[model samples]
Target: MAFEYAPAPESRSVVDIRESYGLFIDGEFADGAGGRIKTVNPATEEVLSEVVEADAADVDRAVAAARRAYDRVWGPMPGRERAKYLYRIARIVQERARELAVLESIDNGKPIRESRDVDVPLVAAHFFYYAGWADKLGYAGFGPDPKPVGVAGQVIPWNFPLLMLAWKIAPALACGNTVVLKPAETTPLTALAFAEICQQAELPAGVVNIVTGAGETGRLLVEHPGVDKVAFTGSTEVGKQIARSVAGTRKRVTLELGGKAANIVFDDAPIDQAVEGIVNGIFFNQGHVCCAGSRLLVQESIADDLLAALKRRMSLLRVGDPLDKNTDVGAINSAAQLERVRQLSELGTSEGAERWSAPCELPERGFWFAPTIFTGVSQAHRIAREEIFGPVLSVLTFRTPAEAVEKANNTPYGLSAGIWTEKGSRILAIADKLRAGVVWANTFNKFDPASPFGGYKESGYGREGGRHGLEAYLAK
Candidate 1:
C-alpha cells in the first residue's frame, strides 16, 4: 500500500490564552487562578495551547457551582427537561464533530481517522443514547423512582478525551446530577470544546463545569465534600488512591482503570482472522487503549503459524502523521508516557523476553514508538504482568484449554479479553469462564452504545455504557 503525508492543520496560537482556553464554570468561560499550563502536541513535540490550570480554589468554586446547580436548578429540573438538554447537546456534538475530531487528533496524538470516525461519532452517539434514558429511568432496573445522586465529580483520561467525557458526563446528566468534570492535563482541548456544545445546547447554568488542570485539581475535585458522586477513568494506581481517598465519604465512586487483557487464539481458530484481531487488539490507537489485548496467548500447536501471519500483518501498518488516511498508528500521547513505555519495554528485554519490531521509520520530531512484540515471554516476566499501555505485545503459549483459561485469568486486571476459535462450543465455554468484563468472541475491541463496558477485578469497578451505566449516577 502506498502511504501519503498530509500537512498538519493550523492550531490556535498557544500564546493567545483567550482563544486557547479558560475554565468552563457556571455555564460560561472564566479565567482560572494565576496558574496556567502549556498544552503540547505529543506527536510533534509542539506547544498547542496555554490552558488554564484550575487550582484548589478554582476546584472549590467549580464544586460550589455544581452543588448549587444540583440544589437549585439541575437536581430540581424535571427528568424530561433534562433529557431535552442532553438531546440538544448530542445534536450540537454531531454538528461540530469535524472540528472536535481535528482538535482531538492534534491534542491527544491519536490518528485523525480514529478521532473523526470512531471517537467523535461514538461520543455523539453516547450522548444521544443516554439522552433518551433520562426520562426513562423507571425502566433502567434501578428501582421504581431512581433519582440522581447529586453533584458528580468526573475525571477522564487523555487516551479518548471527548469519548471519555461523554462516557462520564452523559449518564450523570441523564440521571439529573450536576457535574464538575476535569479533563486530563495533557489533553483538555476537546473537553473545552464539549463545554461550547453544552452552551449551544442551552443547558442550565452550573449544570456542567469543565475545570482544566493536573493531579492536584483532580485530587481536589475527587475529595471535595460537596461532590456527591465521583467517576474516574485512568490507571489502576490512581484509581486505588481515589478509592482510598473517598473511603468513608458520602460520595459514590466508579472507576474504569487499566487492563492487561489476554487475546487467546485456539488451535481451531481461523489464522487470518485471528491475526487481524491480534493486530487490532494491541496496535489500535498506538496501543494507548486501556482495554488493549496486549498479551497474546496462542495455542502451542499453531503458535509458529499464527505468529508468522501476525508479523506479516503488522509489517504493513503505516505509522506517521495522524491526519493521513492511511496511517494505522499515530504518536504517543506525551513525552512522560513515551518514556514510561520505553522503560517498561527495556525491562521486557532484561527479564528475558525476546523483543521484535518490524522495519519502520518514525517521524523525526514526534514522540513515536514502533509496534513492538515480545516472544519467549513467561507469565512471571514484568512485561507479561504489568500494563505497558502502548503498542507493545507480549506473546505466550498454552498447551490446553484449561491452561489457556488459567493463563488468561492470571492477571489482576480484567477489563476485557478476546477469544478466537472456530468452535462455537469452545468459545462459549471459555467465555463463560473468563474473568474479564467484556469477552469478544472472534472479534476484538468492538464497542456499541447498547452494550455495557467495565471491568471485574482490579481493572476497577462500575460499568460505563448501556442501561447498567445509569446505576452509577442513580441513587441506590
Candidate 2:
C-alpha cells in the first residue's frame, strides 16, 4: 500500500484561527482563564495551533453553563426532541468525517488509515446508534423510564481523540443530559472541530462544551462540585485520582482506564491466523490501544516455531509517516509517551528479558519506535506486568490451558484478553475463566457500536459502547 493523504472532504481552506483556540461554552467559543498553550504535531515536531488553557475560573463558567442547560432547557426537553438533535449531530459528523480524520491524524500522530476507516466511521456510527435509543430508553433494560442525570463532566484521552469524544458525549447527550467535555491538551483540534459540528447540528446551547487544556484542566473538570457525573478514559493512575476525587460525592462516575491484556495462542490454533491477530492486537494504532494485547502468551511446546514466524512477520512492518497509507505503524503520540515506552523497554532488558527489533529504517524527524518484541519474559518482569502502551510485545509461554488462564489474569489491569483456539469448548471454557471485560476468541480489537465496552477491576468500571452505556448518563 502506497502512502496517500486524503484531505478532508469538506473545504480545508476554511479553518480560520491561526494561533489561539477558545473553550466552547454556552454554544460559543470563549477564551480560557489560564495562559495559552501551543499544540504541536508529534509526527514532525511542528506547531499546529495554540489552545486556551482553562483554569479554575473557566471550569466554573463551563460547569455553570452546563447546570443552566440541564435545568432550563435540556432536562425539560422531550426525549423525541433530544433524539432529533442527536440525529442531526450524527449527520453532521458523517458529513465532516473525512476532515475530522485528517485533523486527528495530524494532531495525534496515528496512521491516517486508522483515523479514516476505524475512528471516523465508528464515531459517526456511535452517535447514530445512540440516537435511536434516546426515545426508547424504556426498553433498554433500565426499568420503565430512566431519567437523565443533571450535568456530566467528561474527559477523554489523546490517542483516539475524536472517537473518544464521540464515545463519551454521544450517549450523554442522547440520554438528555448536558455535558462539559475536556479533550486532552495534546490533541484538542478534533474536539474543537466537533464543537463546529455541534453548532452546525443546532444542538441546544450549553448541551455540549469542549474545554481544551492539560491535566490541570481535566482535574478541575472532574473535581467540580456542580458536575452530576464524571466519565474518564486514560491512564490508571489518573483514573484512580478521579475515582478518589469523586468519592463521597453524588457524582456518578465511570472510568475506562489502562490495560495489560494478554493474547494467548494455543498450539491447536492456526498459526497464520494467530500471527495476524497478534500483529493487529499489538501493533495496530502503534499500540496506543487500551485493549491492545501487549503480552503474548504462547504454548511452550510450539513457542520456538511461533516466535520465529512472528519475528518474520514483524520484519515486514513499515513504520514512517502517518499520512502514508502503506505505513504499518506510525509515530508515537508524543515525546512524553515515547520516553515512557523507552524507559519501559530498557526496564525489560534490565529485568532480564531479551529485546528484539526488525531491521526497519525509522524517520529521523518523527518520534518513532519499531515494532519491538521481548522474548524470555516472565510474569514477574516489569515489561510483562505494566501497560507499556506502545508497539512492544512481551512474549511468555505456558504449558496448559490452566497455565494460560493463570498467566492471563496475573496483571492488575484486566480491560481485555485474547484467545486463539480452534476448539469451541476450549474457547468458551477459557473465556468464562478470564477476568477481562472483553474476550476475543478468534479475533482481536473488534469494536462495534452495539457492543458494550468497559473494563473490570483496576482497568476501570462502567460500559462505554452498547445499550448499557446509557446507564452512565441516566439516573437510576
Candidate 3:
C-alpha cells in the first residue's frame, strides 16, 4: 500500500487581498478605463480580486509618468542613492516574504513550497544582487562610465510572476533606468504587491510604474515612443511582434521567449539522480517554464531501465492544492492552459505515442492535470515539437551520443538543455556541441541571481542576471 501524508496547508491570513486593485502608476494607485478583470485562484476557481485593466490611454499615462521620472528624478540620482533605494526594496521584500509567498501561490497556482522557497526568495535575492551593482556598474566590463538607457518598458509572463518582475526590474533600476512594467493578465497580484514594496522603499515617483492589463496594454507600452528600451518575457509569437514593432526605431529590445528543451540521459548515468532531474526538468512549476526540459532523449542501452525507474518515481508525486505544503504538482495556471495540455496530450496518443500519467488523484473543482509522459515519441509529434507549457514529457530514445545531440538540437528553441552522465569527458564534449544558452550536467532546474540567464536563437536574446544583465539597461 502507498503511504499517505496528511495535508499541511499554508495559512492565507498572511496576505491581505483587496476587493478591487487599481493600476500602480507614479507612486500611486489609479483606475483604468472602467474595465476590470477578475483574477481567480486556479486551485479553487474562486475570484481572488478584480484587477484594473489598462486601456491604451492608461498605457500612455504610464509611459508619460515613467519618462518624467527618468528625466527629472531618477536619471539624475547618484548611484549610491539608487543603491539605497534598491537595498530598501530588498529589505522590505525579505521582511514580508511570507505574505508575498502566500499571495504568489494563490495567484499563480504554484505549490506553496515553491512560492515560499524558490520564487519569493529568488525575487528578493535578485533585487539584493543587482542592488550591489548600482554603484559599481562601471566595473561591469562595458567601460569606466556607462549611461542609463532611459525609460524601460517591461512585460513579464505568468509562469514565475514576481521572479520575472525581479529579472526585469532589478537590473533596470540597478543601471539607473526608470520603468513602466506590465504583468501577465493571469497573475498580477505579486507584481501589485511589489509596487507596494516600491512605495515602502520610497523609490522616486514613477521610477517604477506597473500598468496591469492584457496583450493590448503590453503592445502599447512596447510601442510607446517615450520608451527607450523594451524587455519582454512571453510566447515567441508575441516576442516576434514586439521585435517588428521596434524594427525601424532606435528603441533597444530584449526578449526571453519559449522553448522545447531536451533532457538527455546516457547509459552510464546514475539512474536515481537522473530520474530526479527528469522529474524536476519537466514537472517543476507544472512545466509552465520556458526552459523546461519537455523532451527526453535517452540512450537505448538503458532505455527500459530508465523508463521503469522514472515511472516508479513519478507515481509517488503528490498533486493537489497550491496552498498545500506537501503538494508536488499544483493546478494548471488557468482553464485555457489546462485545455492546451489536454489538446497536446490527446495529439500525442493519436500520433501513436504511448501515454502514461501518475496515479495521483486530481481535484474535481479546479484546473488540474496529472503529471504525464509519452514514450516512443517521434521528433514529428506535436507533443515533442511544441511547448505545451504544462506537466507533459515526451520520451525519445537514441543509440549514440551524436544521435542524442542531433535530437536535442532538433527544435527551433535553444533556451536550455540538460545532460545526465557520470563520465566527465563525455559531459564536457556533449556540452560543447549543444546549442543551448544554459546547459546542466548532472543537475537540473537550479538558478542563482549571480548567474546570467537567457537564451539563443528563436528562444530569444539578451541576458538577465550577473554582470551581463546590466548591459541591456546601460548605454553602449
Candidate 4:
C-alpha cells in the first residue's frame, strides 16, 4: 500500500467572512445597483459569501469617486505622505497575514501552504517594495519626476486574488494614481477583505475602489470615459477586447495575459533537480499561473531517463483539501475552469498524445482534476499550442538545440519559458533565442517584486513589476 499522510488542515478561525459583501467604493462597503453573486469555495462547493455585482451604474460611481480622490486628495498628496500610507498598508497586511492567507485559499482553491508562503507574503512584499519607490521617483529611471495618470481601472482574475490586487494597486498608488478595481466573481472575498485593510491603514477615500462581478463589470469599468488608465490580468481573449476598446482613446493600458510556457530539459542537466523544477513549473498553484510552464520540452537524448524521473516524482503529489498543509495540489478554481481542462485534455488524447495522470482520490463535492501529463505530444497538437491553465503538462521531445528553440517560439504567447542545462553557454544561447519576457534557467516558478514580469507578442504587453511597472502609471 502507498503511504498515506494524516490530515493537517489549516484553521479557518483566523478569517471572519460575513454572510454578504458589497462593493468597496470610496473606502466604504456599499451595495451595488446590480444583483448579487455567490462566491463559492471551489474545494468544497461551499457558498463562502454573496458579493455585490457591479453594474454600469456602479462602475460609473467608482470611476467618479476615483476621479474625485485623484483631483482633490491622492494626486496632490506629497510623495512622502503616499509612501507612509503604503508602508502602513504593508505593515497591516503582514500583521493580518494569517487571516488573508486563509481567506485566499478558501476563495481561490489553492493549497494552504501556497496561500501562506507564496501568495500572501508576495502580496505584502509587493506593497513594501513599491512603497519605498513612492518618495524616490526621481531616481526610478522615469526621468526627474513622473506624475500619476488620472483614475486607473484595474480588473483581476481568480487565480491569485490578493497577489494580483497588490500587483495592480501598489504601483498605481506609488505613482500617485487613485484606482477603481474589480475582482473576479468566482473569488471576491479577499479583495473585499482588503477594503478593511485600506480602512486600517486609513487610506484616503476613493484612493482604491474594488467592485466585484464578472466580465460585464470589468467591461463597464474599462470602458468608462473617466478612467484614464486600465490595467488587467486575465485571459488573452479579454485582453484583446480591452486593447481594441482603448485603441482610439487616450487611456493607457497594460495587460498580463495567458501563457503556454515551455520547460526545456537537456541531457546533461542534473536529473533530480530538473524533475523537481518540472513539477514546480506546471504543478504549482494547481497550474493556475499565467506563466505556468505547461509545455515540457525534453532533449531526445535523455527523454526516456528524464520522463521516468518526472513520472515517478509526479506520483507522489498530494491532491484534495486546499486547507490541508500537506497538500501539493488542490481543486481547480471553478466548475467552468475544470470543464475547460477536461475538454483540452480530451482534445490532446484525440490528437494522438499519450495521457497520464497521478493517482489520487478527489473529493466528490468540489471541482477537481488530478495532475496530468501528455507524452508523444507534437507542436501540431492542440495541447502543445493552446494554454491549458491547469495542472496538465504536454511533453514534446526536441532532437537538437535549434529544434528546441523552434518549438518553444511557435506559440503566440511570449510570457515565460524555462531552460535546464549544465552548460552555461548553451543556457545563454537558448535563453537568447527564446522570445519570452521572463526566462528561468535551472529553476522555475520563481518571482520577486523587484523583478519585472509581463509578456511579449500576443501574450499581452506592458510590464507589471520592478522599475518598468512604475512607468505604467506615470506621464511620460
Enumerate residue pairs that collide in model 3.
none
Q: What is the lDDT of residue 183 in candidate 4?
A: 90
What RMSD value applies to candidate 1?
2.1
Location of the lowest summed lDDT over 10 successive residues in candidate 1: 9-18
TM-score of 3: 0.99
What lDDT score belongs to each candidate, Candidate 1 first?
0.90, 0.90, 0.93, 0.93
TM-score of model 4 (CA atoms): 0.99
lDDT of 2 at 359: 76
Q: Report RMSD (Å) for each prediction in the order shown.
A: 2.1, 2.4, 0.8, 0.9
* Model 2 spans with C-alpha error above 4 angstroms: 1-17
* Tens digits of per-residue lDDT for model 4, 246-322: 99999999999999999999889999999999999999999999899999999898999988888899899999999
Query: Poorest 10 consecutive residues of model 2 by lDDT?
Result: 7-16
Between candidates 1 and 3, the one scoring higher on TM-score is: 3
TM-score of decoy 1: 0.96
Off by over 4 Å in 1: 1-19
